[model samples]
Target: MVNFDDKRNFYRMLLNSEVKVTIIDDEINSEFVATCRDLSATGMAIEMSHPLEMGTRVKAKIESANASVQALDVKGKVVRIEEEATDLYLVGIAIDDMD
Candidate 1:
């Protein structure tokens, strides 16, 4: 059986994301505390305080922060978003491979 929706869906992507991701921008910017919903080599799902818009570039420090998936600090940009209730958003960030 051929499924059109499944073939074109990006939601089916597999990720090994870690929780407890630390969002760090410049000194003038306050850090955003988030959790990893899923993770890939290039990106991760971060449930953040704000619904970060797509294309917004930011830096992140991959720490268990308090959880178990303690990743190294990384750089990346927002590529996608998922709305979950009010005042909360599921953001998919594509971490920049370079520092």
Candidate 2:
């Protein structure tokens, strides 16, 4: 059998860490706690209790356990969402900018 590698441009890093997600809209700025499942240079997958609408702008932050390491902070938009279970959703975000 021929072996095939992932076709993604960037490699994904699997994670099970808490992520702070903030929805930034013209009228509302709500923050929520979610779990980051996987991350790549351009995108990330997160599991949250509620589903986010597609194209909703958001900011995500992940703090590092080590003091020496910097936290991951990025601004992105919701690109995909899937129902993983009742009251649970897997959301995919397309990273736009990083801080």
Candidate 3:
């Protein structure tokens, strides 16, 4: 028997907080709110009302409630999208640049 587990280098932190997402396409910019499900050093998972197209560029911001923890702001690309419900979608994004 073999044990299986997450293969990523960074462990994912479970987060149930609001995330602000900004889509960057050419000169058009659009913003929306989503719920962040998990976060890691390399990527994050978010749940939103609508699905984003694969390979779309976006910027995500997650503000920390605790003063000790710093807020996360990163530019990433949409890697995957899955429909969870009739109007709900789960989106995966790979972190490209962080601020």
Candidate 4:
């Protein structure tokens, strides 16, 4: 038998944060504010306003409820999008250094 683990990082420290998402496209742009439920070096799961479909790419800022920084700016692709209740979206994004 083999152990099957899905998470890339389970032991890494996760901080609860509220982040802002800027979805940029050639013709359209949208802004969203969401609570970051979990975070890692590679990715984060955010509770957002609208459900970003899987593979949707966007720019994000990891701003906490307390402060803000320049290092939080990054591009991400939505790997999974989950909807809870109505008008709320749980989106899993894969962070990338390359823009």
**For this target, which candidate reaches the highest TM-score against the unseen true structure?**
2
Between candidates 3 and 4, name the one with more favorable TM-score: 3
TM-score of 3: 0.90
Model 1, 2-98: lDDT tens per residue?
Answer: 2445543334334334444433444565465566666556776777667875777777665554566655667788899988878778888887764
Backbone clash tally (model 4) = 0
Off by over 4 Å in 3: 1-4
**Candidate No. with top lDDT:** 2
Tens-digit per-residue lDDT, 7-96, candidate 2: 888888889999999998646789989999999999999999999889999999999999999999999999999998999999999999
Decreasing TM-score order of the candidates: 2, 3, 4, 1
Q: Model 2 off-target regions past 4 Å?
A: 1-4
> How high is each candidate's TM-score?
0.62, 0.92, 0.90, 0.72
CA shift of 25, model 4, Å: 3.2
Candidate 2: worst 10 consecutive residues by lDDT?
A: 1-10
RMSD of 3: 3.1
RMSD of each: 5.5, 2.9, 3.1, 4.6
TM-score, candidate number 2:
0.92
* Residue pair clashes in candidate 3: none
Superposition error at 61 for model 3 (Å): 0.4
For each candidate, the alpha-carbon lDDT, in order, equals 0.64, 0.93, 0.92, 0.72
